[model samples]
Target: MTQTVPRASATATPADALAAGIGFLRREQDRAGWWKGELATNVTMDAEDLLLRHFLGILTPQAAEESARWIRSQQRADGTWATFPGGPADLSTTVEAFVALRLAGDPADAPWLTPSAEFIRDQGGIEAARVFTRIWLALVGQWSWDDLPNLPPELVFLPSWFPLNVYDFACWARQTIVPLTVVSTLRPVRPLPFDVAELRTGKRPPKTRTPWTWDGMFQNLDTALHAYAKLPFNPIRKAALKQAAEWILARQEADGSWGGIQPPWVYSILALHLLGYPLDHPAVKAGIAGLDGFTIREETDQGWLRRLEACQSPVWDTALAMTALLDAGVSAGDEMLVRATDWLLGEEIRVPGDWTVRRPSLAPGGFAFEFANDGYPDTDDTAEVVLALRRMGKPDHLRIRGAVDRSVAWLEGMQSRDGGWGAFDADNTQVLTTKLSFCDFGAVIDPPSADVTAHVVEMLAAEGKTGTRECRRGVQWLLDHQEDDGSWFGRWGANYVYGTGAVVPALTAAGIPRSSPRVRRAVRWLAEHQNADGGWGEDLRSYRDREWAGRGDSTPSQTAWALLALLAAGERESEVVTRGVEWLCARQRPDGGWDEDKHTGTGFPGDFYLSYHLYRVVFPLSALGRYVRGGS
Candidate 1:
């Protein structure tokens, strides 16, 4: 059921709400000059943290109990856990959560355990779980390693020019696959305290049909690889293993994570340990400490519970916060704004990373999503940081001018042949990587996305380069990709609302008339989709099902996204804009922040999602600020 706030008269006006928001943001800023909110995801992060600890023989009783408390609280009444709130129960997530509870000392006959086991059986038991889940089971000796797809360490030897080379995979996938290759080859197993036979059905899983296509070919390749694994040894395998270990070690960030992400961080530790690195080794120890930093322990109404973030977002959050405060009319010279701008300038990445493979000669100038992911500075963060700096208007500061120039050049150099931009690399849209049987889970490749492209276009326009060849090409890409209903797909956020919100502003700023057919059509779509209570939202399901596009219970962040696009298209006087502004003002919390539980941020579209806790504040503040400013 869609949630609706009563349409009572809003007690706050746009100006009043904007002031409250600005004050709220100022209070939240770090003394060091950035603002970072919690990045929340599913229970898999907590579950996986426990599993890693268990494998490392460091699963303390107190830690297991605390994490289990959080995991159990997330279970649905139907005795299953969903990847996102109100989403369908996921077979893999439920399987992992159940096993984590068992490790936490829950008895097999416990009330919670029995129903979850039953749900697992009804959902095809362990056989139906995702490849990653099965791999986890295999690590704990609950499943056979032979049934899982093989990822040979020799993949590290493939040159950049070769198909399916490590670079062909998305940066996140590449970081994970490299370390995973080492683990798969070692095939280490740790014994579980108890068997989970009750969770399994009595019948063997049926073989899936693989037609004569890319998937079929990869399936055949996997079979051949398994046959090869059965050999006593291959002379080249030792060299491949050594090379893979070196590659993993070389990429460990200063914070002791590979790419500042959970999957690669844990897998890299396991890979190194299996290859004979002890727990106390500097690299291994640092990786463990890094994960400890990602842990979040809080006192809930039920009790003290612990959860883990899949990744951190200090750089991304700070950039958006700066933009929001600027939109709210904070002076650039204000102490807080000046501090944030200086901090962002210091965080600028000057070293080349994996992106250099495609743009070997382009000078490095970008920003990473985390505190220290120097190996993978993303274009999305770089774009947003540039925009915020430009908005701050420090034209006389040589440092700021040089940073913006280098970033704009870097962004232009990273453009793909399609005239669009992916988050990490240029031309990283290889379909074969996603087709690999080993990649049956989340996205394995980073393709150009509408949201990322629109941000770049808007950034370029703000830099007064709207007519540059690169900028024009990006605008054309957005025009070509517009959906039939006038919305665009948001690969990095919730469906069409995020995409349309981003594109309309970029188009208008790039000198496309507000009266253009495309702009008017988008305005019509936003007006048509407004909820009865006067807001907007789109479910994560929109990625997989068209019916859910631009339709869901209203959320502050999503509603703000819609309002931004409408206002950009000269809808400041429209009733749609009025109601959206009112919805934001009516819902502002006592502290000026907004309460949002829905996962509007996208990780892998339908397969994975994120709830950026700051989205609720930053987006609405930006929209309300512009609304009060007569849409600028």
Candidate 2:
């Protein structure tokens, strides 16, 4: 069932580009029959890895030097590090990187530290950093524990129905904050190698006098919590800490990661170590070893460099790559695809995790982003994997049928009451916890998003489930959420480009005609926003400001996304389509793949961004293959 139709009157066949990209992707596939391109994030991960090692008293001289080298290499010309490349200088990232480099024995008087020190001080210094940054400072005895907002371990006692309960958080933040509660309660501080006075702005932050707002109320609440922390031991404190530890231990994946992400894995290990779990404890040892797998080392122009990734993305990359390959005419029955399907089938989650709390009666049947993480299976990844399976053209295969049916059922049950889908849980949209001062970084709750919902709807439509009530509800949600300008919000991806691109084709496949007024409006929006370079791009800033969405210097991946949307709307013969295709062709490298330095994959919108190395290559291939296939 591989698509092979070629468009007539084409300036040139995208077959060459598609074939070359496919061959490159084929070589990139692992021996286990899956693909995993590097999931690159910012220097914060590398800096934090060194900081974690320092806290555990296990940092080797060799390892420290290499990590410092990598951190220093990421420094921008203004001598500050950012959360993402080509983004603004981030105060928190600069502070962490500076502290890490100083711990690596980079001299206090080194010229490289001067500009960064100035940047931090001018930006309001260490006190102006995020709550998470302040927590790290407190860990190394650089900041006092009293300065941090309180997160009582007693929070473990809160039932699911209680306000600000653990279940209110998005899975990623929930895992990180749970252990943080334990750490904040213990308030352990290790001696530092040196003071960070040079990074300080020398100005005390003015206390807020406004009493009616989120900041004011959270400030008062934190004051009360802090007072409680100093009171005579309550009997529940012991039981609460014990509950927190047990909660963490129970969620450890088979690979030893808490949630297959850096923050939770690192914090959980630290929290346990403080509770007298030695470095060699089974859980502690496994957690540390699991983190090592996320490190990437390679030869750089300056020499060998080792960087740490915030998380791994095997299941995600494999699904996207498989679909792209099929679009490029790889036979559905190809041995490679069969092997991939077998691998994916083996990965289906049968045991419930945190997601079960939201949908207690829902059956276990979804996939996690990592090889482990059985505790949290995301709807986004599960939907994409189903699409990949369908693209493999195996309708009657027993294993595929079973996995798809279970996943579809899970998706149906996990849909938000709003008729959309969130990343992990059902109806996980509590805005109260996000108002807390400690949650100053990003969205703490996982609300239903346009992009994830679109993928699920698209998958169901492919399976002929569009006639069902569940699919109809999902379609309605997408229509309801469309922006005034016809774009949709991409909660998981970059911005409007990712969301609108995902929604158009999904709606088309779900029985909405491509020429429908709503669909045509979306098509017009994309056409009007096309960059002068004939491609499309969006900045990470778009997540913070609506004006920035669907606007930036052209990138291969975003261009491909727009092209796919246009193709879905029957615009394959349009001028915009040809120009977009040309833009991608002109940008392909001699390696038979595209070169995109922009970080297209979004981890947490404005706070964290990802440059999935394969996205630049994989998505472009899919676009070209579809172009050769005539249209979606």
Candidate 3:
């Protein structure tokens, strides 16, 4: 929707901004008692969605044309597509975008294809692309399974105690690799309408040295596994394949998705289909139905539109939206807040998941990222949900009370050995796993992170768990992990601005004095980093380079994050706070919200970025309200 705000007089205060932003947010809330904004990522999702539909023989001309239009419009003037906007051209994204366009009937001699294909050839061609891309190519007979790394289904049988077991992978990666094992073992290849040979460099890529470095060792292992597959089908191999099939079936979420993310849901469908599950089978049918929910269609200001979220974030979005509304002084027990509480309570996971392998005694009591994904209830979302419930001030409400108690217990159990919390599992910080076998993209293990841990600490403090041992330990962990520049590392969000934003507030809630040296240092870091335009922003590149941390074009979401941090640190009356609030007010549209073009959310650091559409609106509202109320 087009967002516009009333013109502010020279005497306009943060109060005026808060009212405008809140009004805009209230209008945008869904009728279902929750909010769900666009979770935008790269064009790869568009390209991959088309590829999956083609593989299943369900691609429609309309669907193809709509997706192709989105993909083509995203291409840079130089004819290369980037993984994130304004970032360098990525060969993998370019290749995928080019192939999707070709399938959509774009001519081989099309202006974009010529340069994109040349870019692919210049970047070492198909052989140099990431493993996941190569795997996708293999499915359509464009690349050979033999050229890809090996992922044995037998790995499914590895015990939790064993190194490199299936449980060692983060929940998302596990869901993806398990079903993938079936696809690679069967080696099924469905040829595409066109070949991409012209995109390839004539020469073969070099092999890793046999002596075995980190990546080289995996390469050698893959070579040995390849040779073993050629010998014969062993009884053990057949049993492993069966185990994999059952494993896939067992984790399917009640909403019909696997892991609540696109990668696994699509792969699971393909894997089950190859295992003889027909289109009409209940599991296959449900999986197909779930995919439709992730799709989004709307009319952009530029005209027609088509896109797919890499994943949904209803639970996460609802929790934050409720919190932002309440923080902006939405009445406690307000009908909308009450309804959101009911929906959140209904979504809680009652069954144990892979997390049980680590915390065997803990009862299930957390929330997932999407509407489904019972198998992976994340700590980040759980913490935020608990805080949102607390914000309602309904301690006497039985359902809210029950949920808070159970979720708090679950969060405590999920905490790592170091007193910090990882998003999914405890002690899942085995860094060596990243170099082992067929894992090349994104974080492989769920390790303890400062940002996630801080949220839990903040939640605990709010519940009067501040003096408790667990809370104290969590507070210390945050201090121990603080960077020299007084910033914390953002594991789930973008850069130092996100890390500092998250940690300072939690620390303040945990009884850290605003005058304390550490807190003061953090407040200073934020003040110093404010952009020339009186706002704050940080690029995804900060994940890789320390110098880029807390530096970028001003954005509403990141600006709000900074504003909240300053307020939490007792700097509400400071010049930086005033300037930050003014920046948000100046950018507000007539409809009472803000517009952001930069990708502020982080998925896999430099490899992936997100533009949370509601973030630009909700956060600024929350920040402005807190400023008007006189404290965080």
lDDT-best of 1 and 3: 1
Off by over 4 Å in 3: 1-12, 210-212, 300-303, 393-396
Q: Count clashing pairs, candidate 3.
A: 6
Which window of ten consecutive residues has the lowest lDDT sum in model 1?
1-10
Residue 381 CA displacement from its true place in model 2, Å? 0.8
Ranking, TM-score, top scorer first: 1, 2, 3
TM-score, candidate number 2: 0.97
Report the CA-based lDDT of candidate 2 relative to the real structure. Answer: 0.87
Candidate number with greatest TM-score? 1
**Model 2 misplacement above 4 A:** 1-12, 393-396
Candidate 2 per-residue C-alpha lDDT over 336-439 given as tens digits, one digit per residue, 9 for 90 to 100:
78778878888899998888888999989989899888999999999999999866656448778888989999999999999999999999999998898899
TM-scores, all models, native as reference: 0.98, 0.97, 0.96
Candidate 1 structure quality by residue, lDDT tens digits, 497-516: 99999999999998999999
Whole-model Cα lDDT of every candidate shown, in order: 0.91, 0.87, 0.85
Which of the two candidates, 1 or 2, achieves a greater TM-score against the reference? 1
Task: Tell me which of candidates 2 and 3 scores higher on lDDT.
Answer: 2
